[model samples]
Target: MERKIVKVGNSLGVIIPATYLEELGVTYKDTVDMEFNHDLQTLIIRNQKTKPNNKDHLEQVVKGIVDKYLKEKGL
Candidate 1:
């Protein structure tokens, strides 16, 4: 698909179709890696898996494991 660069505030940007983003399993607030390939004259976009910062989530997971271990040891 062809896209034209449009003005975005002070910088130019291209509008990526929503369908393309959906197909790639990406949504708003997701981090993507973009690189320019001079040899191929193409721009590569890839998903950068970002772990969500959830202190409560981590505590819950660790607590679950510790509880299981304690149960197994009967302590």
Candidate 2:
């Protein structure tokens, strides 16, 4: 695939297609890590390493265990 660099106000940037972003599981307005490789002469884009909100996950797990324990006691 080929891309064109267009002028964006003061700087020039390449317009990434929506399909590419969709395939990468990222969308507009999301922050991504971009790196330029001098050896390979290529650009790399990747999703940032961020942990999910695990508070809800922990709460659900505790609730499930409590429910199972109560059920076993016929409560």
Candidate 3:
């Protein structure tokens, strides 16, 4: 597939097609990682960010800490 770079204010930006976006599970307000390949002379794209677990780990750690304190306080 080929794409043209258009001028965005002072920088050049390329628009991604909806087909490719859906195929790659990309959506609006999503972060994407971009890298330049010195060897292949191409642009490399990846999802560098990690999805946060729904269950809060910090809350669990805090609960454990609070439980230990309560036990020590004899409450």
Each prediction's RMSD over C-alphas, in Å, is 14.4, 14.3, 16.7
User: lDDT for model 1, on a 0 to 1 scale?
Assistant: 0.83
Q: After superposition, how far is residue 55 of candidate 3 from its true place, in Å?
A: 27
Give residue 19's lDDT in candidate 2 (0 to 100).
Answer: 85
lDDT of 1 by residue, 1-75 (tens): 899999999999999899988855689999888889999999977556744358975896799899999999999
Per-residue C-alpha lDDT of model 2 across residues 7-61, encoded as one tens digit per residue: 9999999988888888567876888888899999999886654433679757966
lDDT of each: 0.83, 0.81, 0.77
Model 3 scores what on Cα lDDT? Answer: 0.77
Off by over 4 Å in 3: 49-75
* lDDT tens digits, residue span 4-70, model 3: 9999999999998988777557788888788899999998665546443547746765888999999
Candidate 2 residues lying further than 4 Å off, grouped into runs, are: 49-75
lDDT of 1 at 61: 72
Per-candidate TM equals 0.61, 0.61, 0.58
Q: Against the true structure, candidate 2 has what lDDT? A: 0.81
